[model samples]
Target: MAFLFPLSTFLLPAGGEYGDVRASFDEAKLNAYLAKSVPAVKAPVTIKQFKSNPTYFLTDARTVSIQTAHQVEREYTMLAAIHNYNSRPTTAPEARVPVPQVFVLCEDKEVIGTPFYIMEFLEGRIFTDMSMPGVPLEVRRECWLSAVRALGALSSLDPKDVGLEILIKSLSKVSLAQAAVKDIDTGEPVGEITGWRELIGWYESNLPDERKTGVRIVHGDYKLDNLIFHPTENRVIGILDWELCTLGSPLADLGNLTQPWVFDLADVGTLMVGFKNNPGAEPISLEDLEREYCRVTRQPYPIVEIGFARSWMLFRLSVIMQGIAARRARGQASSEQAHLYASFFNVLGRLARGVLEDEGYLPKSRAKL
Candidate 1:
């Protein structure tokens, strides 16, 4: 449906790395003022998820894992991502999503120090694992279905109608400056010695025709863990993390949503969970997920093209992790385990190649490194 990213809930993050960067803001003025501007704000604001009222920094060290920056463009896109989705008419009762209230976007860095916005803090569940530990298996299944159907609802809307047409020009671009990637199995170059541009070409050449699905809102990082589900219900209430929002093929979102199915969750670790061998439950498949999406959108699944999207999504994920590795090397990693990503990217690459072969995008013989 749409390239939705992970499900996440925001809590107030303690002012640390971002504190010094935004020292210019007089909290006495900006703080205590939110209560007056946003009725949703109460005197005592607390942090549950800690993205709660994140203070972003302009420095590279503060580059949030999800494209955090002080640029107005980033804020505009983030606002567009949230506003467009919230503004869309609820075609289905299930499509009604409770999102964090974004009250303002002050571009002038002079206002709250490092260009900040005041938004409501939401309370919900952020399932880091697909297994949805401790939750009933059926509820887990329904939550996944609800996300699918929601994405289907997103796909049904026109970017133009939602006022997101401007995002098409600002689509995220991947740099091909990195060294050539070697095949995980054969230990041979996967593309030309020259650059990744050629490698991208090799896979895309065999992908199904790209025109079928057409353009739609691509969430860029759409996934279950990225969402914020209801506290005790199977439905999605608030959708957060709009840093990666853009306009692209609906398959981009679809491919991302189902990417885990193509790989072994064992390879990635418990941080990620897939339907098959999902920890404590019987193995499941995307048949029902696809069916639900199709039913909501009133369209058949693009089985062939989805392979291309899946491969691309995996590749994109590997690259993101690679970036984390780079950050770790520079001693700017946000997490203590950031260094571990170096080995993970290769597994993702191998998985991508597997999708290409299974989807018939490439001959099995040729796809093997």
Candidate 2:
């Protein structure tokens, strides 16, 4: 699964064009669909594809993003988006993180095989790297705080009250372990040196008895890239990629944010999406970020061992990588980085094992497991 190009190059395409794995839309077809679906939009609407994976179409005044029902149901994402829009607080501090307005939802099979939603394009800057040269340290800190506050606000809401009961569900650690085993069986490449089955077995055995399993709205993929920051102000204006939003442990999102600190960018590229690190800006420690999140949210520091959450996140990421590999194998992957991601399965597994070992969940004598 090794590629001629590095993971960074594979993930980031040149000239900002959609990557090969993306399904390109014919301009005429998109225009036709938009004309009918959004009558308010005038004729001859221009269409340009976003360079990112999960390709989006930018029309005259709005952006159209599409999602397939492969992992999470597209309908659930749509419902979550609507709920976020409707229930967003209007008052002070909590209103800082704004949800983009979802304008239209199209489910017509004739237009496309899968459902797509159109929403207002929030004008802002997305900092792919927190350490970028021009971005000040203060800005980076604000960005981190903004993300923490956003997650806090999200976790504060009751999923049932927001009409997300059907869309959000409690995640089972057992089910996660089972899925990891299945991924290995299904040609997900893992390390021959490490026993994945043993690792998972150890995880199951060490499951926290009084784990904080409280359900909250979890942003499945919360990271620097997924957030839209205000162009001038050092505040988060919008949060993107709601496809994986669900009712789960708030710690899951927190664990995701801490992933970059766990594995270097050079080692894993970008687990979520590839982006270069800002060499100029000093990096923040995972401990500081976690402390900030707890402070902003006023939630107690996690009682469950941090390693458990880290291991779960790593396992979750491995499953996602396995899916990407399966798609690449079937010629359905949208990004060139799919193969690169597939190649990292072993690395992910090893990292998960390392987390357990560091936390003393696994003994040195049994490290091979």
Maximum-lDDT candidate: 2
Number of residue pairs clashing in candidate 1, backbone atoms closer than 3 angstroms, sequence gap of 3 or more or interchain: 20
What do the candidate models score in CA lDDT, each in turn? 0.55, 0.58
Tens digit per residue, CA lDDT, model 1, 1-369: 111122333221212212223223454454355445534444333222123234432212111111224343554455545565666575446554445555555555553445555544344566655555666678778888878876876666666655665444311143232223443445543231222343477655665564555567676777776676666677776555556777667777778888667656676675455555554553235777777777876767545567777877787777676555444444566775665775466666666666776766556644322
Candidate 2 C-alpha lDDT tens digits along 200-282: 66766865443354566777887766776666776776776666776656777877877766664665655543122534334
RMSD of each: 7.5, 6.6
List TM-scores for all candidates, in order: 0.74, 0.73
RMSD of candidate 2 to true structure, Å: 6.6
Best by TM-score: 1
